[model samples]
Target: MAKDQTTRICCIGAGYVGTCTSAVLAYKNPSVRITVVDTSEAKIGAWRSRSFPISEPCLQEILKQVVERLAFSTDIEAAINAADLIFICVDTPTVTKGTGEGFALDTSAVVACVAKIVEVSTSDKIIVPCGTADQLRKLITQKNTKGLNFEVLSNPEFLAEGTAIHDLLHPDRVIIGAENTPKGSNAAARLVSLYQAWIPSDRIKTTNTWSSELGKLAANAMLAQRISSINSLTAICESVGADIQDISQIVGLDHRIGPHMLQASIGFGGSCFEKDIRCLVYLAESLGFRHIARYWMADLEMNDFQKASQTERITSLLGPLASSKLTIAVLGFSFKAGTTDVRSTPVLTIVRDLVGRGHKVKIFDPKAKKEDIQETLCKANLGRERAIVSLNAMQACDGAHVIAIATAWDEFRTRPGLRRMDWKSIADGMQQPRLMFDGCNVVDAKYLEGLGMKVLELGRKQAML
Candidate 1:
């Protein structure tokens, strides 16, 4: 295929990674015709409508512009037959049973997709896997026989949730892994050319097949490790009465250390970090490196501790949440800002614990859908009177004794150093001793005090922080 030639691309899974990646490809490259196929008819229907399956900012707007170029369908076989390239962006979740339970990646989805491809596809096509599961390569090799030719390429995504569009437009780096042979080089170049339309040539990195798979796991593990390291220090700072902000500044000033992903909060929560780190641990253990596996495993343990400790700290502050009968609110429910994905969110654990403690809870998010929020909490009463989903920030904090700013959303904070709340209204809505817990440090404590709310931040005992 030539550099400027139009290509038919079929993405097997239409999820957070698949949908965003395919949307960007279609928008940036008019030469590229993209079809996203998912097994769930409901998801395909949502994608076809103005309302997206995922609540992402500007997603529906962009979908409207690129609707002609992009197609969402449940017809997997037909989409596959018309494609020159197949992108497998299926979910590789943590294994729950059988061999390597809890740490190994479940590659059954990708394997099943490959089987479907073998049954329908008559021509050879380049298959690029975004998930780094080991079983994919073996399945491809075993399935490859007479009258069948498929090339496996690894192209893992490092896209963050909130800034997905921007990241795709100007990626920090693009990784493509193929064999070092001539055929592999040509296949890799085809993908590089597609990205070269928007990304700089130098930013795209090419490697051998195995290196690419290992690199994907290493990248997520390192990011999770940074969060765990900073969180571990936050505990020390809290006990010593030293501010976490001071520690972060002084420690981050180092030229080698730098300042990125070092923000100390409740913990790191998303689809990738914890799952990928545990995958790394499993890989190490399978290789017989027991010590190495345990070393990296501590990060996940520390993250879980951070969430539990945060809940404990808040319950202790209220003292008998059941008898107090307070209406508490959480500002954000999604794993992070900008996307409506609730997988592995720290706020869910906190919310479940609060409900168990007999505290009335309310919630609101700028972009999160009501369905996703309810699913994560696993409570139907949340939509009812038990813990209502508020319309806005003001409504969420209207009748709560304590407000928890769980996710770091821009609207919840005092922007441009300006207060945006009715102090008297907030004060009158709640019972005695109105408290605010700043989980993500988005709210300004002193500024909230001016608005007639007592703010308590994590990792800081006094107002000095």
Candidate 2:
């Protein structure tokens, strides 16, 4: 393709990564025509309508600006037929069964996408996996029968859910990994040109595909390890009556131990952290690095332990759930605030344990859809009536004996805004011996206690009232 010609880009799998990347790419490079295609008509339909399937801050505004150059469709072949470059943005979820079950990412979807591209593509195409392994080149080489040239490149995305748009617009760095050959370098440079539209050339790093793939896994693994390490310290803090926040502040001051992902909370929850760490674990174990695999595997064990300990703490305080028959209000469900994704939310573990013990649990989240919450519960075999979804925090807290702040949302705190939760009003409506559990530590513990409510914040010790 000539530099003068408008680049035609096709992104397979119009899920979060594909949609966001395509929208931002089109917004930055107006000359490029990008079509995001998915097999799911519902997802494509949602993209076309006012009600988008996924939610991210500033995404809608950016999508609105690039509407002229960006398009969404269900026709994979047609998009591939027209595209000069195709990005495989399909989901590579952790495999549940068979070989490598519970640890390895199932790349079957990516493999199928390669076969489809090989079958439909007529011209030389640059194939980039937004997040994939290094085996793509071998797969394409074995499958391509039309004598068409396919250049496989690895360009993994590293955008956090809550601040995805900002991360994309002002990324710390952009990595493009390709083969060391001339064709591979040219393909990498072509991809770099698209990013150079907005990103500074110095911020973009070019490397071999293997390192790029391993780098993503290593990064996520280290992050999860840090979170687990902090959470583990929070447990010791609670035992010794030392505030984890203060401990974190002191430790973070050290230049060697910077402060990021060090804030104490219920536990880390999302799609990436656990999945990526497990992938690293599987890779380590497969190569006979048993000790290394166990080290990474311990992080996951610690996360689970943290969640279970929190549930046990709450249950112990509330007494036997069968005899109590208390109404427990749970605030926040979307793992973390600013996004509506609940793949591996840690709070659900607490909710399920409470409900199983016969407690009435009412839940509310600012951004999570009620239906999605119901679906997640139903999949876990917890009936809709088992855990009622409240319309708002007030509704969830009404007539409740205890309130638990699960997700760290800005509205949950006493900020100077209309959205700030009125704790006094909520406390007035609660049953006697009112107790509040702060999982994310987003509340003013002193103020809440003054309202005759017992506050139990994680990583902090308080005398029994």
Candidate 3:
């Protein structure tokens, strides 16, 4: 593969992964023309807009650098036709219905993209499953491609939502899975050459198709398991009146464990962790690894218990939920900070539990859109009436007996205005004595207590005074 060759690259689905990966690739490889295609015109338009849909610190600068080279469009066919390499970065959301309901990937869009490639492509194109498993790609290729000849490769992404651009620019490794066939090997090499512009050759790992697909799931499962493990410790820590953060710090100091996903919170909440773990468990069950499935299933069980435990604590703090319509202010809806993504947020679980127990909830998030919160809550079976969305933190906290910080958004921690407006002001404006539940432990419990509010913190004992 020539470095200066006009290799056209098309990535289907201008999502968090696709947009970040395409922008970085175009930034790194100036010779390549990267076109990102998505079904949602709004998403594509956002990619082309001044404020990108997703918020990453260096993403906008990188996108600006490759603005000329990178393109976002809804014209999937045209992008596919003009491409040497087509990356199917479409969503493989967990199946909500049918055989593998609530666990398996809904590969309808991926299959559709593959079928479209088979139907429209004029030349020998290299098709890469950019966001999914190699098994899915093989299944799609086998089912859709009869006469069509295309090289299908697996190039799964491991970019975290808030820090996607950074992850893409400096990835740990670029794993490319290719078949033993000449076309497959050529396709893998072509993909590798593009990454080699920025990434060193040593970091580019090559393996058989199955390993590559399974590796993505395995990595996520392991990460989620770590979170679950720490969360499991949180329950024990609370029971024993021990500090989980201190324990985590000590545990992380060990060379064997190290520090990564050791921060304990309400629970693990993201699109990947829970979904991938569920998929892995399902995959194990399907393969007759019942014991293995049960083992992995415990991770998910622990996660659910972790989140549910918070809700139970909230109820315990509030007391007599049936007797009162509790006005609870929830800060931060996104799973984590620095991004507007609300998929599988722990806040939803808290909100649902509160609402189910006849509590009135008012939610506020700095980055999350009102529609996203409404949609997420509705999907969780808690509606708009049950959960009121507020634009500002003050408004969300207004007249509320309790303020719960579900996400560790930077704004929630460092904003002086929020800190200065202490419990006295909040209590004076509320129906009852104010309470603050720091689910993320972003606030100072003593400071809040000084202002005459009850402070409940995760991973730390509540001050008896």
Say which candidate scores most in lDDT. Answer: 2
Clashing pairs in 2: none
Worst 10 residues of 1 by lDDT: 378-387
After superposing candidate 2 on the true structure, give the runs of residues whose Cα lies further than 4 Å from its correct spot.
3-6, 130-133, 319-323, 415-419
What Cα-based lDDT does every candidate model obtain?
A: 0.80, 0.88, 0.82
In order of lDDT, best first, we have: 2, 3, 1
Looking at candidate 1, what is the lDDT of residue 447?
67
State residue 181's C-alpha deviation in candidate 3, in Å.
Answer: 2.7
Clashes of 2: 0
User: On residues 291-336, what C-alpha lDDT tens digit does candidate 3 reach at each position?
Assistant: 9999998998888898888877766656654358888999989998
Error of 1 at 261 (Å): 1.5
Give Cα distance to truth, residue 177, candidate 1, Å. 1.0
Per model, state how many residue pairs clash.
0, 0, 0
User: Candidate 3: where is the Cα deviation over 4 Å?
Assistant: 1-6, 130-148, 320-322, 414-424, 463-465
Who is ahead in lDDT, 2 or 3? Answer: 2
For candidate 3, the per-residue lDDT at 79 reads 93
Off by over 4 Å in 1: 1-6, 132-134, 319-323, 379-387, 415-420, 463-465
